[model samples]
Target: MKYLNALRNQWIAARGWMFCTLLLAGLLIYVMQSYVQLSANMPTRLVPYDLHLMEGPVEVGASAGYTDEDYLTEIAVADTQLHSTWTPNNVESQYARFQNRMTPALYAKVGNDLQGRLPDLENSERSQALFVEHTEALEDTVRVTGRLRAWIGSEQVEDRPIAYRVRYAFSDGVPYVAGFSVEEE
Candidate 1:
C-alpha cells in the first residue's frame, strides 16, 4: 500500500510531462496516418514529364520486341543532341550526362579522350548548337545530320553541316553505344 501511494504521488507530480508525451504521440500517429492515406491515393505510374526532361510516353527501358526503326531514330536524335550541343560552361556536365548512354568500353576510351579536351574547351569559351537536318536509322547504326553553329564568346565563328553516325550494340534490346564517327559536310 505504501509503494502504491509513492508511485501515485510521483505520477501526479509528472502529469504535465505525461500529457505532453501523449499529445506528441497522438500527433505522430495522425501524421503517419495522413501520410499513408496520401500515398495510397497517389498514382502508381507517374507521367513521362514527371520523371524525364522531354515530354513523351514513359519508356520502360529497351525491349527486343520494341527495338524498331522509330526507337533507333529516337535514340539517334537524343544521342546527337547530347553530343553536339554544348557551351564552354556546360560541356563537362553535358559529357557526364552523355556517358550514361554509352557502354563501359566506349566510355573508357571516349571519356578519357574527352577529359583531355576539357581544359581546352573551358579555355576557348566556345559554344555549339545543332539544328537537325536529317536522321536515318539503319540496322545497328543510326546517322544524324545537322547544321552546327559555333560561337566564340557570343560572336558566331562557324556554321556548317555536320553528321554523326552512331553504332549501337543491343543486348536484348538495351542499347549501348559501340562507337561513333563524325563527318563534316
Candidate 2:
C-alpha cells in the first residue's frame, strides 16, 4: 500500500507539470495570433511631421541616361522666361546666359540674331515682360504659353499671346537645348 501510494503521488505530479506546460504554450500561441491581427489592422501610409531641406548640387538628369520630366519642365520655363523677359540694359547679359542652356549650333544662330537686334533694342530702350499662363510637359518637348507685353521707352507698344515649344536632347545624362520655336496659335 505504501509503494502504491508513492507511485500514485508521482503520477499526479507528472500530470500537473504536463498541464502547466500545455497551458503556457496555449497562452503564447494566443498572444502571437493577437499580435499578428493588430499588425494587420494598422495603417501603412506615413505622414511626415516636418520638412527638412538640404543644400547640394541639384541632379538634373535621370539615372537611365534620360531627361527627367520635372527637370525639363523647370528648365524650359526658366529658359523661356529668360528669353522672353528683358530690358534694354539686361538683354545682352540675358542672351549670353543662353550659351549655357543651348546647343552650340542653336546658340550660334540665336546669338547672331540677337546681336543684330541689339543696337535697335538698346536705342529704343525696349523692355518686355512675359506672364506665364500655362505650361505643359510633353515627350521630348515642353510647351509654354503666355502673354507677352512689350514697352519701348516707358510706352506700352504691344500685348500679345505667345507660345514657345522648347525641344531637349540628352547627351551623357546632360540635357541641352536642341530646338526652340515660337508656336503659332
Best by TM-score: 1
Clashes of 2: 0
Candidate 1: RMSD to truth: 7.3
Off by over 4 Å in 2: 1-66
TM values, all candidates: 0.67, 0.62
Per-residue alpha-carbon lDDT of candidate 1 for residues 92-150, written as tens digits (9 for 90 to 100)? 88777778888888998888887788889878879999899899877778889989999
Q: Give the range where candidate 2 is weakest over 10 consecutive residues by summed lDDT.
A: 45-54
Candidate 2 lDDT tens digits, 1-185: 99999999999999999999999999999999999999999866422333245253334443553445766787888889878899988887777776578888887778688678777877767799988898898767999999999998879999999999999877755678888999755
lDDT score for residue 154 of model 2: 79
The 0-to-1 C-alpha lDDT of every candidate, in the order given, reads 0.82, 0.81
The CA-based lDDT of model 2 is what? 0.81
